[model samples]
Target: MSLRQTVAKYFTNHAETRERHDDPALVSHYYKTTKDKAMAKLEEMFSDQQLYDLNAISKEHGEISVYTKKGRKVFIIVTVIMVRPFQTAIDFSVTSESALPFDFGHSNKIIQQLYAQIDQHFTPLDRN
Candidate 1:
């Protein structure tokens, strides 16, 4: 295998692209809106990115799973947990599917891109 593939394999075996962020501001916004509405907005956001096969939408659990394609297939899981009335925690897990052993950080790039899109689409009301 190539060096890039070898390194990717090692890292994939040891680590994964799992990220968590707590956005009280987002929770506050969500609290003002209904869960179904929030889910619809999220679905729209994902669909805007051209994600496909979005399934397993659990409103009670505040979780959604979707798939997208770049050079390879990418699976994304998004979870929005209401910590309190105005506190929310979001988690993202991105995985890349490739025949080769290495993805050259494609999964991480996907997560970053997703985050950027979210921030762009949903700018926090409270900047401070």
Candidate 2:
């Protein structure tokens, strides 16, 4: 990633955890599971009505949209993809609802928190 890209990520209100991200921790995490199971788990997790409120989910497209229950009022979208028979990848896109031009990496932190929760529930695969 370029210097501008790295700098922008910290200042922007939006951050996305994707494949080959500049920060390895922000990269899309691979899990040992089928896409169906991944999606189901995500749905069940968010439906608990704790930190997040489930907005919409598209199992066919492997996408889930949600909002934080409090603090910064973030909008987050999680995407789950099946890369192989039993290997799946999960990604997060987060945006903070704020009037400020920047969020001071709060969005990135939200992604990290989401990843941590996922790690608790899923068997993570080594990134290759």
Report lDDT per candidate.
0.56, 0.89
Off by over 4 Å in 2: 1-6
Give the per-residue Cα lDDT of candidate 1 at 123.
39
lDDT of 1 by residue, 28-56 (tens): 22233344555667788877765566867
Q: What is the lDDT of candidate 1?
A: 0.56
Q: Give the range where candidate 1 is weakest over 10 consecutive residues by summed lDDT.
A: 20-29
State in Å the error of residue 32, model 1: 10
lDDT of 1 at 4: 69
lDDT of 2 by residue, 48-125 (tens): 857889999999999999998877889999999999999999999888988898898898888888788888988999
Best candidate, TM-score-wise?
2
- For candidate 1, list the clashing residue pairs, or say none: none
**Residue 35 displacement in candidate 2 (angstroms):** 0.8
Say which candidate scores most in lDDT: 2
Q: For model 1, what is the alpha-carbon lDDT of residue 80?
A: 72
